[model samples]
Target chain A: MRPQHLLHQPLTTQKCTLGCPILDRCLGGAIPCNSITELVAESGSGKTQLCLQLSLSSQLPASHGGLSASSLYLHTEFPFPFRRLHQLSTNFRSSHPCNDHDPCDNIFVQGVHTVDQLLDIMPRIESFIKNSKSRLPIRLIVIDSIAALFRSDFENTPGDLKKRSSLFFKISGKLKAMAMGFGLAVVVTNQVVDLVAPDEGINGLKVGNLGCLYSSGRRVCPALGLAWANCVNSRLFLAKDDEFVHQDNQLVNGDGGDFVSRRTRRWIHVVFAPHLPKLSCEFEITRKGIFGVER
Target chain B: MEISRLPISASQRGKLISAGYTSLSSLSSVSSSALASDLRISESEAVEILKVASRGSRLGWSDGTNSVINGAQNAWDMLHEEESLTCITTSCADLDNILGGGINCKEVMEIGGVPGIGKTQLGIQLAVNVQIPREFGGLGGKAIYIDTEGSFMVERALQIAEACVEDMSEYSRFLRNDVQACQVKIQPKDILENIFYFRICSYTEQIALINYLEKFMSEHKDVKLVIVDSITFHFRQDFDDMALRTRVLGGISLKLMKLAKEFSLAVVLLNQVTTKYTDGSFQLTLALGDSWSHSCTNRVILYWNGDERYAYIDKSPSLQSASAPYSVTSRGIRNSAPRKYCSDHQSNV
Candidate 1:
C-alpha cells in the first residue's frame, strides 16, 4: 500500500510555530504547530496583537523563528489592526533586512463577520491548500477573536447560552480539522469579565456564557479559567500591568490634558503557558511588539 | 510492492474485504449470486474465490468474525481502564475520594450552582489538578476549557498555580522550579474554531466535528480530560429550531460519551441553573435537555445560599446520587465532611 493510503501515521501531530522569539522558546517551539492553541485574556490584554503577530510571523522562514508557512487569520470583532500590524511588520522587515518577504507571501488573512461566513470560507481555504504549488509551506492559522462571530452570526438570538455554545462547538471542530489536515497552528483570542463576589469563593463572580463567553465560576481561574482554559492544547493568559504599579513616572509629564504619561509602563505577563516550564514571563510592549523582559 | 505472489489487484482484495467474505464460514454460506451482488463481481468469480478459500489450504484468510469482535471488546475493556482517564478531583478531599478517585472518563460530571457559589473557581482548580502528575493521581494532561461566563481570570490561575506548587512537598512535585504563570498557554478567542479541538459546528458541522474529534482523539491520545464549563448556553442559543434541539442534543451527547470512552478522557461539564414556574422558586438546571441529562452518567446540581455556601449532588443514574455540601474557597472546592449548609431536607426529597 502507498504510504499515504496506509493509516498508520496520525495527522494531528504536526507542530507550527508562532513568530514571537520569547514565546517560541517558552513553548519549546511555536505553539506545537498543528495543535489548537488558545490565547485568551480580558479585553485590551493584547490578545489581538498576539494573533496578528502570529499571522505575520507564520510567513517567516525557519532561521528567523518562523516555519516559512502560510496562515489564515479570521477576524470578527475589530477591523484588522492594519496600521498597527503594518507598523509591526514593516518594523520587523526593516530590522531584519536579511529576512525576505516571499516566505510570508503564503500567509492569507480573511475577515469573517458570522459563523456562516467562517463555514463558507472553510472549503475555499481547503481549496487554497489543495491548489498551492509552493513548497513555501503553510503552517499557522488564527482566529483573531471567535466571540464576535458567535454573537453576531447565529440565528438563535442572544440570552441563550446553551445554543451559543453548541454553535461554537461546531465552529471549533471545523477549525481544528482544517488545522490538522494542513498541519497549521491555530491561535484564538477570547474576552473576559470581572466578578462581583457575594463572598470569598471564586465562583462569586458573574460572567458571560454561551456563544464563546465562557461561564464565570467554572472558568474563572487557572490560566484563563473554565472551559476557555480547558479547550486548547495549551493556553496563555495575558494582562497589562496595573497602571499604578508599573506606569512610568517620566511619561507623566502632567500635560496633554488627561493623557500626559509617555512611559505609562505597560507590561504583558505570561500568566499561563502549560508545556513551558516557566509559568510566567514579562514583556514590555515596545514599538516592535512584545519585547521579552525579566520577570 | 515486491512480495506479491497473486495477480489480483489490491482493489479486488479491498472489495472482497468490504463484502464481508473474508472467512470460510461466511464465504461458504454466501451463495455465488449473493456474493456476486454484494461484491459487484460475476457469480463465477465469486464461486472461484470461495472455492479457493474453502480448500483450507493455509492462505491465512479464514478467521472467525466472532473472535475478531471478542478481541476488539477485550482491547476496549483494557483501554477503558487506562489509569489517566478519571474525573478531576475537586479540592475537597472527601468529594474527590467519593468520585472514584475524582472524575472517571466517559462520564459528564455537571457542577451546577447558582452565581457566587464558586462553580468557576472549582472548575478552574480541577483543570489545573487534572494536569498534575500521576503520583498526585492526576491524569497529567492538558485541559480544554470552554468559557461562557468570561470569568476566566488569569490571576486566579496564577494563584492556583502558586498554591499547587506550594502545596506540593519536595517529592510530590511534577513541575520545574522556573515555572512561572506565563507557562500556562491561554487562548481567549471566542470563535468556536478557536475553542481548542472542538469545532463550532451546526447540524452538518456537528457530523463533521464528531468525525474530526474521533480522529483528533486518536491522534493526541494523551488528552485525559475535557471541560465544557457550560454546555447549555450554546444549545439554547443555536438551536432555536426547537424541533431540532432534542436531535442535536442527543447527537452531541452520544458523540461526547463515545469520545470519552474511546479516548479514555474525563468530561467535566459545568451546567447552569434554571427555575421552574410552578413554585416560582429557582432550581438548578443543566442547559442541555433530557437527552444530555440521560446521557450523562453523573448529573450534579449546584445551588447557592447567597454567599460562598453551595450545595451539590450526583443527581442521576441512581447509582450515585448522594448530595454533598461543598464550598468554593479561593483554593478550590472544599467538600469538608458535612457543613451546616448541607441540607438533609433537600436530600430526603
Candidate 2:
C-alpha cells in the first residue's frame, strides 16, 4: 500500500479564458474553473450577448489562456441565436488568432429550455467528450437564463416557485458536477427580478417580494435564492450606464435615446470571484454585444 | 516504505488535481477512475494510489483510514453548508421589526401585486439591500436575480443602489462589493439549459440552494431573506397543460420548503392576482391557489386605489391576517399604517 500524503484527487482551481478581448482583461487572465459564476443585469443590459460572446471566446487556444474546448450553451428564454453566434465567430477569428490560420472548431454550442430536459442531456456530455477524440476538450459550459425553464415547465400555480426552485437545485447540482468532472469552466446567465417592500404591513412597512407570483403562497420558495449563490464559486452582475456609448454617439442595440440620461451609463458589477475585487465598471452593448468601455 | 508498493503515476496525479479532488476527503467520495477521467489520466494508477495511501489510518480503505477521510470530508461539507446561508435586509424599519429585524437568511419569500402595484420594485429593493452588511442584518452577500419578465429594470436597481449609497457607512464593506443582479429573459429551452448547467457545483451548493434561507441563516447567523419577484410571469405565459403545471408546481414547492427551514432565511415571493367571479360581483384572487398558499410562510396582496397603495396579509404562519395602506413612492415600497379617518370611510380590509 502507498502512503497517504500524495493523493490530490481534486484540483479546485482551473482558469478559462473568456472570448472577447475586452472582457478577458477584466476577468483577470481567465475565469476560474469548477465553480459557478454569474453574469447578470437588466434586459438589454447585455447579459445574453455577453454569454454568447464568451461561448465563442472559450474556443480559443490555451496558449492565450483560452479554454481551447467546446461549451454547452443552454438557453432559457430565447432560441439559440446561431446567426449572431456565427457572425461573432467569424468576427473573433478574423480579429485575433494564435496561428491566424488555426480554425475555431473547438467550441460547440447547445440550447435547452426545461430544467428536467437539461438534466436529461447531462450524461450525454460525456459522450461529447469521447466524440472529440480527446483532441477538443470540454472546458467551459454556459447557461443563458435558467429561470425561463422553471417558468415555462412549471405551471404558475400557487406553489410552483418552491417546486421549480427545488428542481433547479437538482439540475444545477448536475451541471456543477459535470463541469468539475470534465475540468470545465461553467458560466450561467440569470434573469434579474425586482424586490420591493410588501404593502400589507402597518407603519409604512415594506416587504421584499420574490417575483414568482404565479407560484405565490407556498411556504417559502427560495427558488434560486441562497442555494444557487452558494453552489458557484463566483457571481457577476452586468449593468449598463451612459458611458457605454462612444463619442460618435452611435445607436447601440439596447441603447437608444436613453444614452444621454445620467442613469444611462451602464455598469457591469463584478459581484463575486476568487481573485477579483468587487468592482462595478462602465460598459456598453453594441451591435455585437456587451463590451467594456474605457473611461 | 509503502510508496514503493503504490502504482500511482505522475499523470494520474495531474488528472486528479484538475478534477477538484485536491483533498483526501474529496477523493474518498468518488471512484478512482472518476478523478482519472476528469484529469485525463489513467484510472489504474489512481486506484493503485488509493489502495496503498489509505493505510490503517481512518483515511485508509480497509482500516480506520476510510473513517478519517470521510470525517474530514464531512467536516468540510458542513463548513460549506454553514457558509451557504444567504441573508438580505429589507430597508424598512417596521417590516424588519416583524421579520426579526430584517428578512431572514437562507429562506425563500414571495411578494404579489397588480400590474403597477410595485411587485418588481420590492424585489429590486431587496436585491440591493442584501448587499448591505451584518450591522444591518444582511450577510454582506451578493444577490443572484433571475428576471423572467422582460422588465428587469437596471435603472430601478441603480435607483436602489443610490438609496443604499445614501445610507452607506465606513464600517460596512458590503457596499464596496457590488451585488450582482442577473437579468435573464429566458426563452423556454434556455431556462432548462441553464438549470442543467447550474448543477455542476459541489453537493453542498445544491443543498444550500435547495434549503436556501436556512443556509443563509446559519452563515450570516442573523441573515435570513430571499425574494422571488412575481413568480407568475413565466408560468402564466407557458404551461398550456394544467396537469403539467401542477406536477411542476408540486416539485417546486418541495424544494422551496427544504430551502426555507434548512437555511433559516426569510423567503418573500411576489405573487400575482387574477379576477375571479363570485355571484354578480367580480373579486380578485391570488394566483397559484393552494399550491402557492401551502408553500409560503406569509402572503401579502397589493392593490391600488387611485394613488393610495393598499395591502392585505392573507396568510401568515404565526401572525393574524391584517390589511394596511401603503404608497409606492420613488424611494421604493413604503408601508403606511391605516388610520381611521371617519365612520363613513369604506374599508377594503
Candidate 3:
C-alpha cells in the first residue's frame, strides 16, 4: 500500500508488453494502463472504429504485442458496429495467425444507454474482472463515448450545472479507480463540437501554417468541455481533412447526382498526455482497420 | 457631457483630460492614484473631479432605494421576452429548416468557411434581413454589423435587400395587396439604415467594442442582431500566445453571450478557417479551434466541394448532422437550384 511498493518490477517500466506495433509511435509508446485515455474526434473521424481496433488488438496473443486477454467494450453511443467488428476481426485473424480461441469470444460487449445503467454496470464489470474464473483476464475496457448518456440525461440548466459538475467528477473518479485498481487500459471515446470560425475566406488554400503554438483557428474541439477534460489522463484528438481530394480520384457518380464520394485522410493529434508528446500522426481507415498513414 | 464643458477651470480641465479619457466612463474606470499621477493633481482632487464628471451619469446603486428582487424581477422579465426570441431567417428554406428556423436570438451562432465562400454575404444578408417587418416573417429588429476584416459589403447588402423587396413584391402581387405598402416596408434604403455598421481593426479594439456593447446595446434597444463578420481575423493574427488569445477570446465570447441573453438579441459570429497540420499533412479547421468550439448553440459550416457550395450543420442542439446545398448568387446566398428528382430535391423544392 506504500508509494514505493507501487513502483516495483513490471510496473517500474511502463511498456505495452503485448506490443501493438504502432502504440509506441501513435500513442507515445504503450497503450497506457491504469489510466483513462480519451480518443476524441468529430463524427466519422473513426473514434469508435479505432476503439474497435484496440479491442481486437488487445485480444491478440501476447506474442503479437497484445495482452493475450479479453476486452470489455461498454458501447454507449451506438449499437456496437457488430458488422464492422465482424468484418475487422475476420480480416485481423486472417492476417495474424490465431491458434485457439475465437476473437469474438474474448471481446465482452455491454450496451449502456443511461447514466444509471453505466454506473450500475461498472462494479459488476470490476467483479467480473476480479472473479478470476474466466480463461482470459480483462486487459482492456473500451467506453465508446463516455459523454453520450450524460449529455442526453443532463440538461445544462442553471440549477443542473452543479449537478453536472458533480456527475462529471464522479464519473472521472470511477473510471480512474477501475483502471488503476485493475491495472487495465481504460479507453474512452468522446465526441467533438465544431469550433471552426463560422466565417473564413478560402485564401491560403493549400498552405496551413502551424505558426501559432495553438491549433490554428480550429473550432472543432472535443465535447464534454474542461470539467470532464480534467478527468481523463490522456487525450487524443482525431480529425479528417478531405480538402485534398484529387480530381482523378473521384468515384463514379453512383447516385447520378453531383454526389461523388470524397476521400478523407485522418490525423490523430496527441492533444495532451503525461506520457505522450503533444504531436499528431496521419492515419486512414482501410479494410484492415485503423492504419497509420505513413508519410 | 464633455470634460472641457465641465464647471472646472480650463487649466484644471486641460490637466484632467488625457486623449479620450475625458469621458465619464473612462474617468470612472481609472484609479484616482493613476489619474493623479498623470494629471499632477492630488488624489483627493482627482477623485473630486472624477466624481463631478460622473454627475447624473450612471452612479452605482445606493443602499436602500432599490431592492435586489426588483433588479432580479426585471432580469427575469427580460429573459422571458418570448416576442424577442425570434430568428433572422437566412431565406434558404431547407437551411432554415435544419437550423430550427434560422439564426436564433439569445445565443451565439458561428459559421465558418474558407475565404470567399459567402460568409460575409450571409452576414450582410442577415443584417439586412433582420429589419424585415415581423408580419412579413422577419425579426423586425435592427442589426449591428462589426466588420473586423473590412469584409462587410454595403453593396452586397443592398443587392440582397433589393432581392428581398422583389420577393416581397411578388408575395404582395399574389395577395393582390398594394405595391406601395410592400415597397415601404421592404425598401433597400430602410434596410441599410437599420443596420448599424462599424469597422474594427485589432483584437484590442474588438474586445473594447464588445465591452462597450452592453452599454451601447442598452441605449439602442431596437438592435437585436449583432454580427461580427469574421470574429477571429484580428485575434488570430495578433495574439502569438495561445493562452492569452484563448483567455481574451473566452472573455469576448462570454461578454457576447451575456449581451445576447441580456438584450434578447442574436449574436452571429462569422469565423475564418485555419489549417491544423498533423503528422505530415494539414487539415482545414475552424479558427480558434476547440477552445471556442462549444460556446455556440448552433453552427453552420459553409464549404465548397468541387466548386459547388454547400452548408453543413456542423453542430446543433436539435438538428442531426445534415447538409443543404446552397450557392452565392448576385442576390446573396440562395438555396441551390433543385436538381431533377432526387427525393431530397423534391422535399427541398
Q: Write the per-residue lDDT of candidate 2 for residues A1-295, one digit (tens) a residue.
A: 1111111322124467655556667766546765567665556667777777776667667766667776667676656777777777677777675435333355565668567678788778767765666456677777777656654566644366445544554565565556656766778776555434433222122112212221112112223443244334466665443433433334554444344434355655555443454354567666656567665
- Fraction of the native A-B contacts that model 2 recovers: 0.05
Docking class of 3: incorrect
- Model 3 chain A worst lDDT run, 10 consecutive residues: A206-215
User: Could you tell which candidate, 2 or 3, scores higher by DockQ?
Assistant: 2
Q: Please give the C-alpha DockQ score of model 3.
A: 0.01
Model 3 segments more than 4 A misplaced: A1-295, B1-84, B176-183, B339-349
True contacts kept of each: 0.06, 0.05, 0.00
lDDT of each: 0.55, 0.53, 0.68
Q: Ten-residue segment with the worst summed lDDT in candidate 3 chain B? A: B59-68
**Residue B91 in model 3: shift from native, Å?**
1.3
On TM-score, the leading prediction is 1
lDDT of 3 by residue, A1-295 (tens): 0111111224222324322355346664546676667887777788888888888777666556567778899988766799998998888778776445568878889999897787787788878988956578987888888878777777755435435655655665566566656667888888866545533432223111111112223555566654465456567777776753344323564554444456676777765454333356777787777777555
- Residues B39-99 of candidate 1 have per-residue lDDT tens digits of 8988888777666555442333443222222234444545555543455667676666545
Residue A285 of model 2: what lDDT?
Answer: 62
- Candidate scoring better on TM-score of 1 and 2: 1
Candidate 2 docking category?
Answer: incorrect
For candidate 2, give the lDDT: 0.53
Write candidate 2's Cα lDDT for B225-330 as tens digits: 4455445544443245767766665666566666556544455666665544356433556766656567666666676553355666666654456655654445
Question: Distance from true position, residue A1, model 2, in Å?
Answer: 14
